[model samples]
Target chain A: MGDHDAPFDEPIDDPLAESLRRSLEPDPTLVPSAERVAAVRRAAERRAAEHDRNQNGPDSLRNAVSSRSLRPLIAAAALIVVGMFAALGLDRGPDGDVEYDGDIAGPGGDGTLRVVEIGIGRLVDLDTSDLAILPTGEYYELWFVGPDDTPDAPNRISAGTFHPDADGRSQVSFTAAVNPELLPTVEITAEPGDGDPRPSGVVVMSATIDR
Target chain B: MGGSSSRAARLDPTTLRQVVERARHHDPDAWESLYRHCYPALYAYAGRRLSPAVADDAVSDALARAIERIDRFEWRGAGFDAWMYGILRNVVKERYRHVTTQALPTDPAQLAQGLVEGEDASTALLARTEAAQIRRAFAALSESDQDLLELRVIAGLSAVETGQLLGKEAGAVRMAQARALDRLRAALRGGLDG
Candidate 1:
């Protein structure tokens, strides 16, 4: 069969195909409700605002001060504030709690994984927007892997197991008794229900802990 | 293809790409336009496999995820509709994992609407019967077959566009679609015989 280059090529002349098409035709009147559309728009706007804030954070302030004809005192004061914020580690959760954050991505999905040391153990918070849903009898497992980890001789500790919601968005928090300094790599894998306590090696997402 | 009012069908690829670009820059109007364009097909795809209520939530969730991940979206010439459908498909599959039973809408009158041009009573009745038959036959096919046909007939995606969403070669998709149609026809015949 020769593939057509056109994006939406019309179907061939077949009565069955035509009838199937008519039967499955989308109902024109079945539009999304205005409220639903508004909700989506609100979500988009919120994400946009967050993105803008991230993009225009400390670097943007430094650039604005240096590029403009500002007074020396104001520029120096702005720089000092930026420096203080950076030095204080504003992203840390609380006093004596070291936080590590990184992006986890692989084919068909991506997410953010955050680890925080809460004195007793580590807390992992995973937020994925587009992870594929595993079939029944299978689930996704999170692992904190050490530097010497390998496929054959895997050196890792399980944080938890979870399945994404119907929306393929998973926001989960799990507490594990491990240290981020020892297990600096985080991994997510699709594991079968075989009861085998081993890394399946089917890594869907992985990232190094960025301190 | 004949009577589809899907906004995606109305938008040319160039205009759609422009709108997607604007949405990438976080333009509210652009996102609105994109949502309207893709909503019809996305709803149809989800509604076919899910209950009406779940379908609505699935579409909303797909759009929400699209907004969050729009920054990472790259243009590959399949247009934004395919991209939105890709997300919706994943959402639908996730829903399927949780659901042991699907609530497919099989109302003959509802399925028959707009299938025929004339408003005549007899024609409408015939349309309803035929539509019911088609729906039954369509449902009897394997899930993979139904998915292919849904992409081709319902979503109005070309083989190439379906391939892009499914991560398959265009020729392979075309061949598979033909095979799927054959299976559907066989299923229809089996239904009639039964």
Candidate 2:
């Protein structure tokens, strides 16, 4: 029998292996947000468009212009098309500034927070001071809960995790792929270091912000 | 090999080829399927190795690069995920260079993306304690051991697939995995006992 067929007597659910599994496997429900998916789609579209132009545009134009022998016009046209696609590949989000701010309410009413929807993704900035101390072995996680009408109905995207200082204060800045408009509710939940990917259902603080 | 065939059975051969073909042609459905298929595994691997912020950027950049270079990617024995992983390694390497040179992050707020936000505080605390113990043992392993674990567990690649990426035979990969697990178990025991 090949090595692959050599069955080990050892159980697959050995404690060490289970621990490794728990530590490594992310939350199964975790997925790319709609905005992230849209960004990728847009990027792929631009690349596909560029690829098509590279394949057909120059060749067809070359054939046509070759019949008339209009070499300079073909060169100029190719350059213009290349330039246009390059510009298309650039940031497609709004040119204007888009920002949202609100205060998170907890035992001590944690400080102000900001969510800036820039091109492609959202920038989440959180600041807290003199908040209630969390129990040992727990940290705070930032979540972006989408609006009720979202297709997922009730979905929350984890921004990331953080732990406050000795004084029960923390400042965090991170980017998330969620749409700022879709995510009006920002929640902070105390989470364990366990491998579970979903929020712990413990809402330490929460706020509704307008964009 | 039986293991190889079993894992390969999950991906229908026809659908695999079709996904690649349609994605090359810029079919939205195909692209979405491909993206969704690879994103979770890629995110897990990158998130463990780097901060969530860098991990997200690396995944996005890797997918964009794959889309741009899809035409050039030939269907080798491995699937599309393997090819994408190769690109992702390069991107992660670039970021790793930057991270290693910079001073470690001092912000107490900086934490990895993965956390258990379950309802029971006591359960969560026990889980965290166990997780921390496991992490310490894992860190005690050799770099090669860590890499193998990362590829198998974090990347969620089957033994045969991991073998293909590492250019080793399936038999050798299985042996390595067994030995690595054994070492990890010993390390964990030592941590608990000592």
Candidate 3:
């Protein structure tokens, strides 16, 4: 037979209830460790990425990434460069292919913009002008930040490095391991040209690849 | 159910909604905030019901599951932590079934147990002995009694929240909780008498 000594109406503050709470309480120190939180957060982020991939096919994902990265930037800087840059960035060539354009904003953002055709993924007909010539020995490296938005190496893929000419203008483009359309954001970092593998904290410019 | 409210009720509902919205958008900062807010209580609940190692796994798996199914989650006033506990309850139940059917260990707590942290010899020994006694007595109760106690004390849920999770009215949960507590008290006394 079970003891029914206590009133059923009040279970919160009774002696037995307090004892149960205390007996079952876990060690205070281990309840919410940072390591556990980090592990769970990483797992959640992985699931989020997987969910994104499943919802949008790889082809559509390219456009999705492009739109996601660009929407905010364009909304913020919509009319800032209305007449400054002649190329509207959305202009299509005679071949009926639309051109993708974006603003490189940071240290030397003055009149600096990039135009490329990322339809098939890689940079095709990459064009950029009005770049600030860096001091000798410092070059600019291009990077594509994936949808993860983490600065970690796996998500930050380096496209390549290039040097500007005496006129502060140069254009040398090539294929990259990751599709710009898929990653959708371009980050230009000022590197010391010493062949360091990781991106330097000196990010000079960031641009959104508007599809 | 009318006796007390959940810890989640202390958090502002508007802020929780905003955090949930941000988390659903996959905002890292917002997600981290949500994780930190819910992890400790959920961990304690899992650790109490299962071993620490299994608790860790269940909490991680539950968080991942919650993230995947976040879009389907609607704010029904039960709060986010309650929703998370709901997922964790199912995960722990599944794990409990698997672990119970396995070979019994020298420590019966492994049958479905409480987590004890290691400490200095004398203090650790004393705490462990008491915790073990309570745990054993807790295990002796009927499944429903054990579950009600676990949901109320281990999960630290209020009568209302427990009622929501268990699909019982607050008044019913309180009545059930009182009965479960009486049994637990008797078990503890029985340990003392023995």
Candidate 4:
């Protein structure tokens, strides 16, 4: 409890005393996604390499060396990394989609849509924390390259894309009500950040509720 | 405040903050420990709010994100539990778009995730009843109250981060959260009685 001194409308000091705290709690175990980490590392390394090239090139290098400055670029890269991660942590509201902001490629689709075959193994993982959920606020958005549909398909303009965390792991399965495990759920394709609510991409991933 | 030293129980704020610090360093032990510590609670919270698969996805995704940002593990005298819990809440919210399409998600995933596994009808019924009660109680509160409760009880966020999520100061949140809880307690009590 805290000092109930500051605000006239402060919360009660003993807020949930009568309520039952979880007694026999389940273990908070996370299923690790190793494949994702590798992909993230690879991507990060690639970017780092490209950065190295750009900095060492005759023109940029001369500009930096002549003026004797490297901190700015370092700061810039740091900022970029922070920004990239910050993007990862974001779950954009209904209208934050940037159309073609940073979507690398389509997730899964046929030629008509340019679908990418996505799987748990396909995502890039970079977190050293061994956490199942990546640090990114969301997973990467996927696209159906063929005949697609978004969340509210026929209605919404675009298919819904489930973005991955920094490690690119997103939940695509739904739970059953009665049997909990008896019925299976469907999987939908990931949509781009197009600022649409309804999922408007082709159904790339799906599975019936596994009984 | 959480009362009674619960080991794997609701990780009091201090332990939670330490877990964040450990998880940040890629400490597999700490990572696993923290993951194991919060995942199920998150699962339950997500379950209450979403479908099973979506809940798992949210919990799993949250943990993955937690891994990446371990480097940003700012203790700030806050419990890692609340911080991580806050992340889980976002995961649930973000995944909602697709989850909405799924017809009936909670029951199946709840069973699958071993929430209310094979047991007597009474046991399952009781658990379901309690869950339903909680959900009903949760819905009765204001959106802000619901958010705070979910963050505190379900998400297990710290006072500071909880404030950050809702764009308020920790002290203000602490006060608001306590009041919110009082209101919730009243609501739950009334629901239980009336």
- Candidate 4's error at B46, in angstroms? 2.1
Q: What is the per-residue lDDT of model 1 for residues A1-211, given as tens digits with 9 covering 90 to 100?
A: 1112236575755678889988878765455676776887898789889988988897778887686577787869988998987798864666446567777875435788777787669988999865555545678899999987887877789999998785667999999998877888888877766899787666767888756
lDDT string, candidate 3, B1-194, tens digits: 00111322222556667888988867666666676556656676665556666677778777777777687566543457767776676666644535532121326455334545455554755666666677768877876677667767766666666555554556776888888888888988997898
Comparing only chain A of model 2 with the true chain A, what is the TM-score?
A: 0.48
Worst 10 residues of 2 chain A by lDDT: A1-10
Give the residue spans of candidate 4 off by over 4 A. Answer: A1-17, A20-211, B1-30, B101-132, B153-161, B178-194
Q: For candidate 4, lDDT tens digit of each residue in A1-211? A: 1111212232334524323234213334433244433433344344446555765797776677557377777788988898976777543322232112111211121111111112221121111111122123322232222223334333111123334344324433211122212212233433333555444332333323222
Q: Candidate 2 on B18-81: residue-level lDDT in tens?
A: 7879888877667767766666667766665667767777788788877877876665434566
The C-alpha TM-scores of every prediction are 0.60, 0.49, 0.47, 0.41
Residue B27 displacement in candidate 4 (angstroms)? 5.0
Report candidate 3's interface RMSD in Å. 21.6
Q: Sort by lDDT, best first.
A: 1, 2, 3, 4
> Model 4 fnat?
0.05
For model 4, residues B39-73, the per-residue Cα lDDT tens digits are 55666666656666666667667776666555555
Chain B alone, TM-score of each model?
0.81, 0.68, 0.70, 0.61
Give the poorly placed runs of model 3, Cα more than 4 Å off: A1-13, A31-39, A50-211, B1-17, B100-132
> What lDDT does each candidate get?
0.73, 0.64, 0.61, 0.46
Ten contiguous residues minimizing lDDT sum, candidate 3 chain A: A1-10
Q: Of the pair 1 and 4, which is ahead by DockQ?
A: 1
Q: In model 2, state the lDDT of residue B76.
A: 44
Ten-residue segment with the worst summed lDDT in candidate 4 chain B?
B1-10
